[model samples]
Target: MSGRCKGGKGLGKGGTKRHHKLLCDNIQGITKPATRRVARQREAHLGAHLRGDAWDVAGLTPSHLELIYEEMHGMLQVFLENVIHDTITYSEHAKGKTVTAMDVVYALKHQRHTLYSSGG
Candidate 1:
């Protein structure tokens, strides 16, 4: 028989057990005030950059901006989730302890959102 024990729960090295960290509620971080602030900033930028009398005269209501913000926020959340999930998958497949920029690039490419360059 070999020196190593067989059919046993082997805690490698110093017998340290790995603990899985719990995921926090990230959605909670995007508070109503934060969303409002972002929406207002976007509205201001658009108002400043857009040309033509129609765009100049037309203004978005506060409620309209909020709705638009919610829609954009949801889409952004989904996109980030997909990208992060794919990045983690690639890292794990390569037995990597940390995610790299290349992992993100590859993940984006996998989702048909490829970037032209990964530099800097």
Candidate 2:
């Protein structure tokens, strides 16, 4: 018998190779108009909230509001950073590619900000 295998299951010498496009090319499908629309919507929503009754009740001047906004934003940023860091740590420890609700719950619990039990 010949040295060659009977079946043609072996890898062929010549075939058109599949070329995957770059990730950036795929991301380019989200056109500029769609991005602008989302930005405009967010701007409008934020403007409405800034002009809303909540701020009206506070009766703070623009300067005072700006100061408070900066302080509150800084505190929120720090809090979010801590929570996200903890969440990512939990996810990495569990060898999970995606963070689940349980990971978040556990992270919050670890930080003494427990939301709810894992069980129903």
Candidate 3:
């Protein structure tokens, strides 16, 4: 097996009937770093920084980053969807137009005030 990646090995009916090779190339992918950007890692770093003020982050590990990243991303996705949906509904019915960036900004502002406007 050469270093070049291979796919679909055929071995059936004396090489007459080609059988699809289910396990061809390595399923785990190459050992080297992936060329694509990993968003989860980036998200984790942001979360670590956000909490660094109150917690010691000098000994954080890759696994910890991934766990925090997953939770942050999961919760943010849900929150964003809800925010966008509410803004879209209001903008469409009230203004009779498509949503815009201002809609998002307004939604965010409204949510912030609604949730965090306590005596200040």
The candidate scoring highest on lDDT is 1
Clashes of each: 0, 0, 0
Write the residue-wise lDDT of candidate 1 on 10-119 in tens digits: 45644656899977657546876676566566577678554344323138787876676677678768888999999999999997879999999999999997788675
Model 3 lDDT-worst window of ten: 27-36
- Those runs of model 3 whose alpha carbons end farther than 4 Å from true positions after fitting are 1-56, 113-120
Q: In candidate 2, how many Å is residue 98 off?
A: 0.9
lDDT of 2 by residue, 1-120 (tens): 786856644467546777967543233354545544644565676786544453341476778865755554555457667988999999999978799888888888888976755741
Off by over 4 Å in 2: 1-57, 117-120
Best first by lDDT, ranked: 1, 2, 3
Candidate 1 wrong stretches, greater than 4 Å: 1-58
Per-candidate Cα lDDT values, in order, are 0.74, 0.65, 0.56
Ranking by TM-score: 1, 2, 3
Winning candidate number (TM-score): 1
* Model 3 clashing residue pairs (backbone): none
Q: lDDT, candidate 2, residue 30?
A: 46
